[model samples]
Target chain A: MAHEHDPPLDPVFKSSLRELKWIIVIWLVHFVWVLGYCSTYGYLTPETPLITVIGMPSWVFWGVFVPWIAATLVSSWFALTQIEDHALPDASPLPEKSEADEKGGADHE
Target chain B: MNEGSTAALLTFAGYTISVFALAILSNRVGKGKDFVGEYFLGSRSFGVWAFALTFAATNASGGSFTGFPALIYTHGWTLALWIAAYMVMPLVSMALIGKRMNQIARKTNALTIPEVLRARFESPAVGLVATSLLIFFMFFYLLAQFKAGGIILSTLFADEPLFQSAVSFVSQTTVNIPWVNQAEPDYLVCLIIFAAAVIIYVVYGGFRAVVWTDVMQGIVMFVGVILMLGMALWQVGGLDNATRKLEQMIPPEHGSAILSTGTVVATDQTFAKGTWLFDTGKVFRLGELAIIREGQSSTVPVKILKITTPFEVEGLNAKRISGQIPDPGLTVRVTDPKPYKYGAGQTGNYVRNPGPDSGNDVGFLAIGTAISFFIFWPFAATGQPSNMVRLLSFKDTRTLRYSIVTVAIYYSIIYFALIIIFCCARVLMPGMEIAPDQTMPAFAAQLTRDAGIPWLAGLLVAAPFAAVMSSVDSFLLVVSSAVVRDIYQQHVDRQAPEKMIKILSYSVTVIVGVLAVLCVLNPPQYLQDLIVFATGGLAACFLIPMVLSLYWPRMTANATIAAMLGGTGMHLGLTCWGYIADKEFRAYSFLGVNPFIWDLIGSLVIALIVIAVGPKPNRDLVLKFFHDTTSDGS
Candidate 1:
């Protein structure tokens, strides 16, 4: 707990873990929501005429295409904003300025 | 050789030689490095496009190019729904594992999935078990790819000079052995040639070569599918007209009345359950094979004006349409999936039974089956070790983020485009072949003939051929690496020299490639079945432990071992029992779903319960595992 020369560190790992859970939950919700629409909304009966999209059934369009757009947006948004790139906990403890880059990983600036 | 066939063969040769050149160049580039990292992981330096295309190409496999098209051709439009899960697949799989796996691999220099798991869990046993399971399922998966390669080559080149000569030479010189199918001269020759090409390129260039070739293959795959789609639709007139003609093939008043398809034509012929409703318009003369394509554009009947002949129902005449029959102005408007068969001499029509076995023999005619299919793929996708290899090989999180988006978009366009093209193929090539697996090549061949562009046939064959190679190369590496790196190096000889590892890597790649081909010489079933069985086993074994270990800190070594071994055992037991009990090919049905689901869910439950009841895991170990790579303390 007492490594010197680095700014006093507040561990964000626990909160990040919490944030990860929330992200997972949001992803799951989107999955369930899409499946729900597919099974519930698009599962049409014979008497009902299916609207065609791109020359396919309306239900299929909603089931696959709509969620495709939504998923693209949702995933990209999550990747951009929610995923904060952090250094892994330094397996080696060193002065803040001289944190060792194990194997000098090329990713480290 | 015909000029067109000669041209096509030359084009194929050029593509293969170019791929070999890339591999040779990459081998030079990859010289002087640790064999394990340089060979298997490419020293973990792939930029955005390399990573994205390789990842996509690896997953696209022969199934994507061949089997999927077959399903769409045979079963109809529901394939659009079946493969829809792919749109969210990259998000489900990549978003969860990509950044974390890359971070951890860089931190620990973990070169393989087992290496990653072993490091993450701090348990050699976990690594061993995972590696064993990977090798096992990868065999089945790899064999399927080989089978696909053989099938593609045989179908596309059946009329070629080399193939015909080889077949004649083999049959004339050889006697039929009890276990061997001496009849399949073309399949054996293609399998050997395909296997040789893949192993040589992969063994020489290692991961770098694989990735470079994957880039080429990925582009070929996209172009091939798009051009095939355009050609198929063009041959059938247009999308609007194609779907229109396809609708007419249906007997009006079943349940599939989607796409503004046709209402039934008032027929002068009403044959009962004995046979199909033939020539609903009563226009074709005797001895003419008339095809009844379902209509999507209007109420008028669209029938193919050709027929071969089937006198099977001559004695069972129920009732020919007398002068005045009601139009039944109401057309069935729902597009229900069903398997139908009609051709020369076959008087039967594809029927839709809303009761039981609705939508022909495609049992997934109901809502639940559709949803279940959607769920299986994404779930199985996450558990594949080859995919994990891709996840761990990315250069950075930024690369990962971009690849995820790119793959999602790529799959969406490619899979949907395939559905349209294959659906249209059903119209252009009516009753083309009985076996669904033959449809893609059949369609491609038909396209080449009709368009009079023989070189296009080379491109079409190359697409699936590329998919198979992309999948097989990665799998060969994964299987061989598990033996060399995880087993021999990690456990057998920690101090094994780099030279020995390099030699072992290359030789093991060849041996594994050779073994996969031999197993399929007596292949029990179709390539699709083999792929599914292997995928199920792999997912059942790895999905829970791998995904859970990533996020959950409390996961203990005991849980990992139990999940790894126990899950694999459970899948084996269930599949074995299912196989022994059922006469049908879909032998692994645990509670009406593919055994993968039950096995995965069952395995996860077992794992969680084991963790719940076991001793409190070492908090320090847990912290150490999670701490170093994922978060910064400051």
Candidate 2:
């Protein structure tokens, strides 16, 4: 199904995309945990005995502070251990020459 | 000036001189490299510390120092949830786009975001549109930071005799100049000084200067927050004590009032700005200078003074006075007092969600708005072109990976510690609600003075100043590069010589900075609001299009343009609607959510629609950017 002009995908591009997928997943988890927990317990009724944990509102301690620490740990782990390092391609010729080459060659096909 | 003021000024001088030294050294180091590449991109060589700190410092603008602290002092503990998203912001902002953007830029030899987009699509139109939007949004962003710089400097030198003399001289000299004369003399002088310093350093040294300065600024911000945290906790006994006190604290009622003399006074009496006056067992601080002119019954524009607690009154050292006293003959008759819509006379508002707001009935951070900010901090940060520029300059993926972890821990400490320190600020410095933006600097000065080490305030105040300067310099370079490289070299002169490029770059950077200074003569109040609007607008315009172009090979030029223009239009349209409906500058949250949420949604929808209907992109272009053409069509 591949076109004649299309070359194989770059290995670095494939590797980077794979890492991006994991990063997005980690971000989504963090997003849900922060928004879900905070929105659920943030709005408290005046009659509810204002609970305190370590001198902070109990909800904040559990919702934001705890999740924040956890997210930091997860993110650090992912960045340090999970992400792959790859060799970047050398800088190409000036953009004008490349543009002219493309226009003269396969771009018009 | 007192010893504290003198020491603070001297320390500030030393910091400024050191920055110039760095800029000069950076310029000399870049002498042999490609002029444009080295000046704008630092020859694409950034180590972990340089990249991480520059990225972090640029993101931590005036809003972090002035606007954010103001919100914390006013709204209390609710700010925790508001800013909690920063915990993952480093990973989200950097890791998501860093490697891909770097690869793309290197592949295209692109020096700017617009340049990268242009090269990706092979269309000059895309570059032009991107350039236009970048300049437009960045100008507003520059105005906000310039205003913050002026405010910080003004606050730092509030008691200095030299600064007072300069303010007075400028006021007298510019009394007849229509535009310049309208601003407060102190603020105007400070704005000019701040603008000049930033412009000179950036124009001379360029990108390397910005990165080097950012490294130092980042360290100052981190150390400053830690010191303040320790001192604040010690001053307030502990976080628990501060929280308990905050629970019982009442929000002040602020509004303009008419101060009348009970009798026509025999002598002309003048009350300086920030003077504390007491009447009817209540305490108030004059927001501006009040002069009872000879033989006049009242002063016409006696700016606002809020009704604060007697506990604060004792600390304020307020004189025993009444509204209708014959001896001094000063009558404090309040008019048009505007009380808070929520928690006006209540306790326990500070430590709770939907905290008390001076005007908003929905309170400061409604649940919907809270959800919006959690998304805003990371995703919006990712959208910033300034951050994108830093992404392009890091040495390699290892540097990227390590810096991500470093910034994650750095922001965690800075943002969380700021909340704790400013919450304690309410206990130590009352009546700050009158001028909330000055809370950080004022608190720094007061905290150190109380500790009998007033000179330390300079280093603490420098944290915010450094933040503003780092952002301003980066933004100046961005706007300059847009004009020089994106617009000029791409369109006007592809073969332009290097010497001409250097002259234009410097000239454009200085011109833009000066214009920004002039624009902020009467700066917007609540600097955080302006910061949010500009930053949100930029994210709305650029985030989706840039992401798609980097990853999705099928994306066409038309689709990218649609996303940028449509996103910006939605954001501006909503902001205008909000202003017309509310008679204020804030964005109209159509469904109790921040306008940023809707803007992103709308941008994505528009981009998807365009991509669906538009012609397919060039397959050859995809081959170039997304595949290994170097390996020959295998």
For each candidate, give its TM-score against the true structure. 0.80, 0.94
Please write out the lDDT profile of model 2 over residues B1-634, one tens digit for every residue: 6987887799789988988999999999999989898899999999999999999999998789988999999999999999988988999899887898899899889999998888888877788899999999888888888888888888888889999999999999999999889899999999998998889889888899999999998998999889888888988899888888888787888776667867676777787766666555566777888888788867776666665554665544433434222233356767878788987877788888888898789898888788788788899999999999999999888999999988988888899899889999988788888788889988998889888888889899999999999999999999999999998888788889899999999999988998898889977575556777788899999998988888887788888889999899999999899889988777798977878888988888998998888777777788777888878674
Looking at candidate 2, what is the lDDT of residue B233?
90
What docking tier does model 1 reach?
Answer: incorrect
Please state the interface RMSD for every predicted structure, separated by commas.
9.4, 3.1
Per-model tally of clashing residue pairs: 31, 0
At residue A106, what lDDT does model 2 achieve? 23
Off by over 4 Å in 2: A1-6, A97-109, B176-178, B260-263, B297-331, B524-530
In the range A21-88, model 1's lDDT, one tens digit per residue, is 75567556656765677667554443344356666556556766777777777766766677666543
